[model samples]
Target: MGKITGFMEFERLEEGYRPVPERLKHYKEFVVRLTDEQAGVQGARCMDCGTPFCNSGCPVNNVIPDFNDLVYRQDWKDAFTVLDSTNNYPEFTGRICPAPCEAACTLNVNDDPVGIKSIEHAIADKAWEQGWVQPRIATIKTGKKVAVVGSGPAGMAAAQQLARAGHDVTLFEKNDRIGGLLRYGIPDFKLEKFQIDRRVEQMKAEGVTIRTGVMVGKLPKGSRVTNWAKETISPEELRAQFDAVVLTGGAEQSRDLPVPGRDLEGVHFAMEFLPQQNKVNAGDKVKGQIRADGKRVIVIGGGDTGSDCVGTSNRHGAKSVIQFELMPQPPEQENKELTWPYWPYKMRTSSSHEEGCEREFAIATKEFVGENGKLTGLKTVQVEWKDGKMAEVPGTEKVYEADLVLLAMGFVSPVATILEGFGVDRDNRGNAKATTDFDGGYATSVPGVFAAGDMRRGQSLVVWAIREGRQAARAVDEYLMGFSDLPR
Candidate 1:
């Protein structure tokens, strides 16, 4: 517990952000972190709940109450120790996680939830500021080698943990940069690359060897994470070279909207457009930048990717921007009694949505109307949920001018190269087939080749990817050494 009656004393403090006008001008992060005094007050709001559901609610199982109490007591060192005990990378989660812990806060039953994520952001940012974050290399060497495929959160977390466990860890990334989606798929405006670079340096100091520009398995001549892979190694070769291999390449197959004029020149998968901007922000001059400048941009899909596209388009100074969602608009507020201690269903308006843009819900894209081998407009119709299915309203069909069409509909599965090369099984959802049991957890169908993260679990948050990676590292360590001390 924090302050005896802190919940009654301090109100929840939401993280601040720069206004859209200021933030959209540059491809950099503009989120305002909580002040030290504010963080301390918010930390004090943690109650003496017999069961801290926030801990369980978090995918990474972050120790919520312990750190809250520590920060409240002004014990900075101990707070970080507690925080790093479970989450391998708080910085990543602080920026990208949805913070389900806030939803599960005990105080949320009646009052506003403790500012758990805000406090976490402050703590992690402060730790970095004070140079408190450093390498935690082991004193003893176990003489074991582990290879982590993919440099996303899951692979990065597992590599760090396994290396600290006295193993020689080598992390392989198909991209030129270490972070997989974080380095490419995600725009820099949301998360600055420096945050990832500093952490990567720390991991390197901890004896984790990151091998960027290296793809695994028998890949096509052009298949790579980004536009950067110097060499390709097969799965059998990796198994022969390393003691154990972990597959965490992530689900990269973009779900396509197969409709008329899908092959138009201005239409592209969101990944193709988003990554180019990220590379440009990283100071790499992409020959052909997929830009929305001076064009009527239309983003399809309503989730995080779509929101990201909307924000990116605004930043690009598009002529006009619009987003379409097939699902009906959800209620603004959730029924607390029915959804307490669990994530609730409600309308989520992101920061990108706050920026100037037209959003239409309960509408389905009928087709892409193109001219002269280019997308000219989009056909749409009003939709309603009827008899457990979406039915279009008659006479509600409409068309809107669009020069650039970005399909932000989300990913379907991991690319088929490595899975097929290793003969790894796949689930019905097209993710890597694996179990989460204490015994042989995260082990892939192919022996000596394990799987974790988005590649294993399909599309999910960065926090969940880190959790899977950390747990998979523990499993791999146990399998190698019979007994291990790595945490899940």
Candidate 2:
């Protein structure tokens, strides 16, 4: 987009991260950003194709070519403007999103895709460095109030948009901090807490009231913030107090393996293990911190959550880490022509795997064996997929030594407590039920109540959550004021 022959002339270059040996010592972000000159060269690799599939691939539909052109010219401020116009938090997506945009890049049909994510990262970082990133206080008060539940990317985006549209927005969270999964579920090695903190600060400055440590409806003992209000507010109170309500509470119900020794001490959910380490990294004094040091960790899942456990256990100096997946291994290389502008089925070995991990595919845990209420090992069996179902192979059972068994199996649906607490209709998959069609989009069966993000649409990427949040804001605004200028 920068030069007529730019794509042909320049080779793509990506930002470098620190060496794993050095980075494994601590949990700080190890990613090395591209220099302005390097980023400019990468930007020049954009072909500006007749149709940019990157736009369709990106959940928020970012103007990839325009931003690439602006970065090539070193107009970082404008780049951020263009990026922020679509994405509410480029910083989050820049770090953790799978970047379907890159997979859908036209350049990938032949060679490596243009470094779109890195460029977006560079633009956002430069904007903040130059203090160009600022809160947009509403110019006029709309005199309407809105209650947004949860402070994850979705809730944050919805709150910011509604506030910018002059709504008195109050974002509530049960946790002591602001972010939902971004605060706790995500390990610090991938994304530091300060990233969430910085964005939360901006949201606050933009006229959004972030009320943390305040659980809606009923909370079990020890769930309340010690310094905040003591009692839980009913859903009826919230509806009465606010002009509209948006439920962005994330899907947090972790799927568990109901095998023998499921209730053992060392056997834990990924959420239980991941959150404790994150809290410790944030300087909290956890009484019994989850540690994998000198322990054989058997992580039962092969997705991002399992990879995170591998990385965390490596950082904890674990004796060994083994990951198991129920599905058979995918082909390493996809049929490029067949999968060319779409996400293809292929095995993805993460950076954590690079650190150290024994990956076992098509393996399912059969039973957890333990002594004295503590998990010690697990029995697994290899299976093959046939006729759209898995069939266990005869004589495929094996015992894997495990001092700690982390069920990294993905979440099933939104945690029922809060969703049920609000009495909202749910889909068959247990997510909040809502439609995205223009007429009453995001509106739940409950009047004046809306749902979006993982809570509404199962677990997904941060970028999708942001998109849902922004669109849901427009829906809420329209429901309140009869029309909304907020971008969908």
Q: How far out, in Å, is residue 387 in model 2?
A: 1.3
Off by over 4 Å in 1: 218-227
lDDT of 2 by residue, 1-488 (tens): 86668778888886787898998999998889999988888888899689999999999999999999899999888888999899888888888888899999998998888999999889988888899878999999989999999888999999999999999999998777887878887788888988888888888888999888777876444321112334467788999999899999877778889988788888888888887888889888877877899999999999898899999999999999999999988999878899988988898988789898999999988899988888889998999988999899999999998999898899888866677877899999999999998879999989899999999999888899999999999999999999999999
> Could you list the CA RMSD of all candidates, in the order they appear?
1.5, 2.2
- Judged by lDDT against the true structure, how good is candidate 1? 0.89
lDDT of 1 by residue, 1-488 (tens): 99989999888889898988899899888889988788889988999999999999999888899999998888888898889889888987888888899999999999999999888888888889888898999999999889999999999999999999999999999788988889887778888899899989999999999898887875545543354778888888888889999998888888889988898999988888898898888888999888999999999999999988998998999999999888998889889999988998899998888886888899988889888898899899999998899898999999999999999888888988779888899999888899989999999988778999998999989999999999999999998999779988
Which pairs of residues collide in candidate 2?
none
Record all residue pairs in model 1 with backbone atoms less than 3 Å apart, i.e. clashing: none
What lDDT score is found at residue 407 in candidate 2? 89
Native-referenced Cα lDDT, model 2: 0.88
- Give Cα-based local distance difference scores for all models: 0.89, 0.88
- How much does candidate 2 score in TM-score? 0.96
